[model samples]
Target chain A: MTGVEGYMYPNEIRLYWSVLIVLYPYITGLVAGAFILASLERIFRVEAVKPTYRLALLTAMAFLLDAPLPLLFHLGHPERAWEMYFTPHKTSAMAMFGYVYLWYLMAVLTFEIWLDYRRDIVLRSQQTKGILRVIYKIMTLGSSNISERALNIDERVGWLVTLIGIPSAFLLHGYVGFIFGSLKSNPWWDSPLMPVVFIFSAMVSGIAAVMLFYMLLTKMRHKTIDMRCVDAIAMYMFYIFIIDFSLEMLDLVHRIYEANESFRSLNFLVHTKLYFSQIILQILIGTITPLVLLFITQVVKLPEIARKRMYTVSGILALIGIFAMRWNVVIGGQLFSKSFLGYTSYKIHLVTREGLLVALGLTMLPLIFLWILLKLLPPWEDEGAHAPAAGD
Target chain B: MNGFKDIEHLFRFAGLFVIAILVFLVVRGFIVPKSFGEYGHYRAAAIPQIAALPLHYAGHQACISCHSDIQAVKSKGMHAGVNCEACHGALEKHVLDPINVVPVKLNTAVLCVRCHAASAAKPKSFPQVNAAEHANGIACETCHNPHSPAIDAGGTK
Candidate 1:
C-alpha cells in the first residue's frame, strides 16, 4: 500500500523478477565478455594481451560456473529445472538456454581451457607428489605425454576452439539480451539494439575485469605489472564503452523523440524513482567518469605509476557501470506497471533465498572459486620451476 | 608415430565427453513423458489434469436453487448476465455444506465501485459514477437493491 501509487493491476503489484534476475544477465555477460577477451589473444593473436589470456579464461570459467545458481535459486521449484533440457519447449527462447550454456561450457570454455593447459597439467602431474600429484594426474585425464609435437597440436586445436568461442560468446550474451528485448509488452526493454548494446557492454566489463585482475595479481605476486597488456585492454574497454553508451543514448533519444503513449510514464519513472540508479550511478559515475579516465590515459603520456593508477580506477568504474546498466535494465523495467498508470517498488529481503544476502554471497562465490582455481592450476609460467621432479 | 602416441589421450577424452552426452540424452528420453510433444511443446496430459480439478464456483443454477427470491429480482436487472460468483466470490462450499461454510458478506459500496468508479479510460457508454460524489459515505444498498438496482422505493417498479 505504501509503495503503490495509483492503479496497478492486482497481479502487477508484486514484481516476478527479483535482483537475482539482474545478476543472471550480469554474470553471463561477464562470462561472455571475458571469453571474448581471452579469444583476442588466442584468435586475434594480440601479443600484448597474452599475459591475461589464461587469467581471462579462468575468470570466465569461474563466473560461468556461478551463472545458473541465481536462476535455480529464483525458481519456485528448482528441482524441476531439468525439465528445460528433458522436454524443452521449441518456441520458448528461455528453454534454449540450457543447450546454449552446455555448448559454451563444454565445447568452448572447458574444451579450450583443457587444450591450452594440457601440457602444463601433464608436466605438473609428473613433477608433484602425494595428493597434489594425484590431483594433477586426474586432471590430465591419463594424458602425460607433453612432447613438442603434442603441445603443438594442443595449441592448434586451442586456437580453433577460440575461433569458434568468439561467436559462441556473442550468442551466449546476445541471447540474454534477447530474453528481455523480446518482451513486447514492456516498452522499456523492447528494443532491437538491446542485444548489440549488451554485447558491447559485456566486452567493456569483461576487459575491465581481466585488466584489474592482471594488475592486482601481479602486484600481489611481487612481480611488475604488465603495462602493455593493461594499456591494450584499457583501450578496448574505452572504445567498446563509447559504443555501448552511444547505443543506449540512441535508444533513449528515440523514445523521447517518438513520445509514444508510454513515454510520459517512463519519463516520469526515470525522473523520480530511477534518477539515482540510472542517471547518477549508471550514466555519470559508472560510465562517463570511467570513459574520461581511460580517454586521458590514451591521449596523454603519463608516468607508469600514474597510468597504472588510472587503469585501476577506470577498470573498477567500468565494472560498476556495467553492473548498474544491468540493474537498471532488469529492475527499472519492472518498477512501473504495464498499464503506464501506476508504479510499484522493489523491497530486497536480506535473509530470503532470493534476497540481498544471497545475492552478495553469490557474487562473492565466483571470486572464491577463482582463488581455488588459481591455486589448483597456477597460470604463471614460473610454477614449473618450484614443482618437484618426476624422479623425486 | 611417436608424435601420434602423445595425442592419443586427447581422442579418448573427447570420446568420453561425447559418450557422457549420449548417456544423458538416452536417460532424458526415458524420463520425459510419452505424450509430451503430441500436441505442441507442453505435456498433453496437463490439459485433462487441469480440467479434472474440483469446481470451486457454484454455478448460477446452484445459487438460484437456494435463493429463488433473489434470483427472480436479479433476473429482471442489468446484472442478470453477470455471474453471481463474480461479485459474491466462490459459494460452492456454502452451497454444499451450509452448516460449516457461510457466504461472505461483502461491503456493498466497495464491490459496486470496483467496476463503476469514474475513470477516463472506461468506455463513454458504460455507466461510470464518481463514487465519492454519488455515495457520500452512504452504502449503495441504501438506495438501490443490488438484485434490481433500477427499481426504487418510489413505487416505480
Candidate 2:
C-alpha cells in the first residue's frame, strides 16, 4: 500500500467523504423497511401475513441494534459521538440523530412489539424455567396479567405506534438523504430530490426483505407455504418498486439535464466505476426484472406455486440490487478527487475491520438475532391460544 | 414424551456458538496493535515526525540572539513574526554542529499538503492552493519568508 503522506490537501479545507457515510443509511434503511413490513400484519390486520409479522419485527430489532455501529466506527473519535446528544447545537444536522433514533426505538418499535407479544410473554413467563424465564420476566417488566381488556388495550397501542411509525420511517431515511443533499461542496450530491428517492428506495428494500425472509423460513422449516401472504407482499412490493425506480431515474435525468461543470467527471465516473451497479444491477436486474415479474404474476392471478416462486426470486434479487445501488452511491461517489483533476481508486482490504469483512459481519448479525427471537416467540401460534372464543 | 424441548435448546446453543466465533475472528483481524502512547499514534512511519528536533521554538530564539544582524535584516524584511524554528523544525542538532548539520529544507509542496490535507485541524491560514498547478513548479519558501512571511518581506498587510 502506498502512503497518503503529504499527498492529501490540508485536512481542514478538504471534505473526506467516505463509504462509511453511506453504510450508516444503508443499515438504517434495513431497520425502517423491516419495521414497516411488520406493521403491515400487526397494524393493518393482514391475516395472510401473520406468519412473518413477528419475524419482521425481530429482523428490524436485530438490524437496528447495529445501525449505529458503522457511524461509531467511522468517527475519528468514536467516544465523542455521544456528545452530539449531550452537547447538541440546534443548527447542526447531526445532532438530531439521537432524537430520531430514540423516537423509533423507544416509543414506536418497542411499544409495538410489547403490545403484539404481551399475551405470549405472560404465558411464557409462567412456563419457561431458569435464566430464560428471568429474561422474559425482565422483558415483560413485571406485567404478567393477560385479559380481554388488556388484549384490547394492546391492540389499541399497536395501532397508535404503527400509525406514528410510517411518518417516522420516512423521516429516518429521508434525513440521511438530506445529509448528502445539503452538502454543497460536492456538486454530484447537491440536489433537493435526494430525500424522496431515499425514502421510496427504503420502502422497496423493506418489503423485498420481508418477502424473502418469509419464503426462506417456510423452505427451511419444510412447512406448507402461505401463498396468500406472499401474493399480498408481492403486490405491495411491485407498486412501491415502480415508484422507487421512477424516482431514481428522475434523479439521474435531472443530473443529465442540468449538465453542470462537475457533470462530465461525475458521469464518466459513473459509467466507469458504477456502470454495472447503477445501470445493470439497480435498474435492470434489481428494479425492472423483479418489477415485471411481480406485475405479470399479480395481474394473471397465477397459481399458488408459481406466485410463491416468483415473489421469492424477485424479492431476493431486489434486495441484492438495492444493496448494490447503495454501494455505488456510497463508494463510487468518493473515488474521484474533489479537485476534479484526477481519479483515485479505493482498494478495500479483504481482511481488515473497515473492509468487506466487517460489512458482511454487520449484515449477518441480524440473522442470528432473528433466530433467537423466533425461539422466544413462535409467531405462528394460533390467536385462539391467547384470546377467548368469539361468542363466549 | 419426545425430546423436542431439549433439541430446541440445543439448536439455540449451536447457533450462538457459531455466531460468537465468527464475531471474534473478525474483531481480532481488525484490531490495530497498540503503539505511539495512549492516543496510539498513527502508524505513518513513512513521513518523519517534526517533534524530535529542537528547531521548533527555542532554536529560533538562539538564531535571533546570535545572528542579530541577519535577524535585523529579516526583521526589516518580509519574514518578521514567524519564529525562526517554525520552518527549520527543531534546531538543536544544527545549533550544536552548525557546519555539519543540514538545515531543514523548506523546498517541496509536500510540506504544504502535510498541513493542508483535509484532515488537518489547524490548517495554515492561506488561500487554498491549486495542487495540480502549484505543486510541481515551485518551492514554498521561494516566494514567502519561512519565519514570518506575512509580516516582513515587503510588508504587505
Candidate 3:
C-alpha cells in the first residue's frame, strides 16, 4: 500500500515480471544486432566493415550465451525450464523460445563461428601443446583439413549460414518484441510497431557494443584501431538509430492522438512515475545525446582521435539509451494496473533470486564470456598466422 | 575427388549434429504428458494435479462441521455467499489438526473494512462505511457480529 497510489486490483500489487525480464530482451537484442552486423560483411559483401566481422560474431555468441540466463534466473522453477522444449505448447509465444534459442545457438551462431574458424582452430590445435591443445582438438571435432579446397568449402558454407543467420537474428529479437507487443491487455506494450522498433534498436545497440569493444580491444592490444570499420559501423548505427527513434516516436504520437480511455492513466504514468526513466534518461540524455554525437561525426571531418572519442561517447550513450528503452518497456508497462485506474511502484531487491546483484552479475557475465571467446578464437585476422598460444 | 575427401569430416560433423537433434526430439516426445494438448495448449494432467493439491481454504463444509452455530447465523446473513476463509485466512491445517494449528484472530476493523471501505468505485448497493468516521478507534466486532455483519449485535452467536 505504501507504493500503491490508488485502488489496484488485489493481484496487480506485485509485478510478475522483474528487471530480469527487461535484461532478457536487452541481451537478446544485442545478440541479434551483433549477428546482423557480422552478416553485413559476410552476406552483404561490405568489405570496409570486414575488420569488425569476426568480432561481431564472437560478441553475438557471448551475449547469446548470456541471453537465456536471465529467463532461467527469473523462473520460479529453473529446473522445469526444459519442459518448454519437452512439452511445448503450440499457442504460447514464450513456449517457442526454447526451440528458437537452440536453433540460433547451434544451427546458426555456433555453426557459423566454427565453420569460419575451422582452419584457425586446427592450426591452433597443432601449434599449441598441453590442456588447451586437447581442448582445441576436441573443438576441431577430428577435422584437421585446412587445405585450399577445404577452406573454400568452409567459406561457402559459412556464407550460406550467415544468409540464414540474418533472418534468424530478426526472428530472435522480433519475437521478443512480439511477446510484449501482442499483450492487448496492456496498452503500454500493445503496438504493431513494437517488433520493427525492437529489431532496429537491437541493431543500434549491438553495433554500438561491437564498436566500443573494437576500439577498447585494439587499444589494449596496442594496435591501430581500424578507422574505416568504425566509421562504417557508426554510419550504420546513425541511420538505424534514426529509424528506431522514428518508430518509437510514431508509436508515442499515435498513442497520444488516439487518446483512448486508457490514455489518461498511461499519460499520467509516463509523466509522473516514468518521468525520469522514460523522458529524462531514455529520450533526452540517452537517445538524443548519442544521436547528436554520431551525427556530428557524420558531417564534420574531425581528427582521428576526436572521431574516436566521439564514437566512444556515442556508443556508450546508445547502449545506455537502448537499455533504458527496455527498462521503460518492461517496468513501465507493469507500473499501472490493467484496470487503468491505479498505479504501483517497483522496489528492486538486493539479495533475492532476481535481485540487483544478480542482474549486475548476469550483465557482466557476457563480457567474461566474450573475453574467453576472444582468447579461444582471436578475431584478429593478422594474428591467424602467429596465433596466440592457447590460454594466452 | 580430393576436395571431397578434405571436407568429408565437415559432413560427418553435420551428420552428428542432425542425429543429436533427432535423439533429443525423440526423448522429448516420450517425456511429454500423454494427456497434453487434449483440451488446450497445456498439459491436461496439470488440471487434476492442481485440483488435487491440499485444499488450503477449507471449503465451507469443513468449517461448518465444527462451527455449526456460526454457519446457521451466517447462512441467513448478507455475507452468506462469502466463505469463512475470505476473511479468516486459510484454515486447512487448523481444520485437520486443531491442537497444533490455530485459526487467526483477525482485527475486526481491518478485516471487515476491506470490503466495506468507503470507495466511489465500490457499488452503491453494497454496504459501505468509513472506518475512521463510523467506528473511529472502535473495533467492527464491538457493534456487529462478523458472521452476520448485517445484524448489529454486541456478541457472536
Candidate 4:
C-alpha cells in the first residue's frame, strides 16, 4: 500500500516472481545461444567458427547443468519438482519444462558432449591413472573402442545429434519464451513474438558469452587470439543482434502505436519504475552501444587491437543488456497492477532465499562449472587428444 | 555375435538408457496418484481430501439457533446482514466445547473501523466514518449499540 499510487488490487502489492525468475530465462538463453553457436560450426560447416565449437559445447554444458537452480530455489517445496515430470499435466506449458530440460540436458546436450568426447574418454580411461581415470572410465561407459571405425560412428552419430540439437536448443529457449508468452493474464509477457525474440536474443547472448570467454581464456593462457575465428563469430553475432533488436523494436513499436488500455500503465512503469533497467541499461547501453561498436568493426578498417577491445566491450555490454531485458520482462511485468490503475515496487532482499545474493551466486556458479569442465575435458584442440575431424 | 564386439560399447550405452527409462517408469508407477487424470487434469481425491478438513467457523445458522435473543435485536438493525463470526472471528472450537474454549473478548475499538474506515474506494452507500473526527479517541461501542448501530446507546451523538 505504501508503494501503491492509484487503486491497486490487494494481492498485487507483493511481487511473486523474484530476481531468481529473471535469472532462469537469462541462464537458459546463454545455454541455448551457446549450443546454437556450437551448431553453427558442427552443422553449417563454418570452418572459421570451428575454434569455438568445443568451447561453445562446454559453455552450454556448464550453464545447462546449472540452469534449473533459480527455479529450484524459488519453488516452495523444491523436492516436489519431480512431480512436474512424474505427473505432468500435458496442457500446462510450465509443466513441460521438466521434460524439455531433461531432453535438452540428458537426451541432446549430454549425449552430444559424450559423443564428441567419447574418443578422448576412452583413451584417457586407459592412459590416465587414479581418481580422474575412474571418471573417464565411467564416462566411457565400458567402451574401450576408440578405433577409426568406432570414432567414425561417433562422429556420424554426433553430427545427427547436433542436427537434433539445433531445434532442441530452439525448443529449450523458445519454450522458456512460450512460458511467458502463454501467460495471457499478464500484458507484458503475452506476445506471439516472444519465443522468436527469446531464441535470437539467446543466440546473441550465447555467442557473445563464448566470444568473451574465448578472448579472456586466450589472454590468460598467453595464446594469440584467433582473428579469423573471432571475426567470423563477430559477423554472425552482429547479424543475429540486428534481428534480435528489430524484433524487440517491433514489439515496442506495436505496443506504442496501438496504445492499448494497458499501455498507460506499462508506459508509466517504463518511464518511472523501470527507467534505469529497461531504458538505460537494456536499450541504450546494453543494445545500441554494442550494436554501434560491432558495426564499426564490420565497416571500418581498424587495427586488430582496437577491434578486439571493441568486441570485448561490446560482448560485455550485450550480456548486460540481455540480462536487463530479462529483468525488465520478469520484474516489470509484476510491478504494475492488472487493474491498470496502480503500481507496486519490488526490492530484492540481499540475504533471503530468493535474494540478489543467491541470484548473483547462481549467475557465477555456471562459470565455476565451466572451469571444472574445462579442466576435466579441455575444449582446446591443442590440449585434447582427439583433433577436430573433417566431418564428412 | 562376432561383429557385435566392434560396437559392444554403443550397445551398452543404449542398454543403459533403456535401463534408466525402465527405472523411471517403475518409479512413476509408485508415485503418480491413481486418481490423477481421472477427472480432467487434476487429482479427483483432492476434492475429498479438502472436504475432510475440520471446520473452523460454524455457520451463522448455528449461532442463531441458540442465541436467538441477540439475533432478534440484530435482525431489525443496520447490522442485520452482518454475520456473528464477521466481528467475533471463528468459533467452531467454542461451539464444540463452549465451556473450556471460551472465545476471546474482542477490542471493538479497533475492530469496528476495519470496514467503516473512510476510503474513496468503498461504495458511497456503505456506512463509513473518519476515525479522528467521528469518535475523537473514543470507542465506537460507547456511543452506538453495535447490534443496532442507528440506536444511540449513550445519547452522546
Which scores higher on TM-score, 1 or 2?
Answer: 1
Regions of model 1 farther than 4 Å from truth: A384-392, B1-6, B46-53, B61-76, B93-107, B117-133, B151-157
- TM-score-based ranking, best first? 1, 4, 3, 2
True contacts kept of each: 0.54, 0.00, 0.54, 0.62
Q: How would you encode candidate 2's per-residue C-alpha lDDT over A1-392 as one tens digit per residue?
A: 24222223333122254455556777788888887777777667878777778778777777777788877766779987755654456777878967788678766776677678877876777767999888778766565556566566567767887889888888888888888878888676778888887777888888788778778877887777677787777787888888888888888898899888888878887887678888899778988889889889977967787887788789888887888777776766666556555455566656655656776776777778777877777666543124344894
Q: Kindly list the per-residue Cα lDDT of model 2 for residues B105-144, writing each as its tens digit.
A: 6664566555443433234564456556654556665665
Per-residue CA lDDT of candidate 3, range A259-294, in tens? 988999999999999999999989998899999998
DockQ winner between candidates 3 and 4: 4
How is the predicted docking of candidate 4 categorized under the CAPRI scheme?
Answer: medium
Candidate 1: which pairs clash? Answer: none
Error of 2 at B136 (Å): 13
- Give all candidate RMSDs, comma-separated: 2.9, 10.5, 4.3, 3.7
* DockQ measured for candidate 3: 0.44
Query: Global lDDT of each model?
Result: 0.87, 0.70, 0.90, 0.90
Model 4's i-RMS, to one decimal, reads: 2.5
The lowest-lDDT stretch of 10 consecutive residues in candidate 1 chain A is A380-389
For model 4, the DockQ equals 0.50
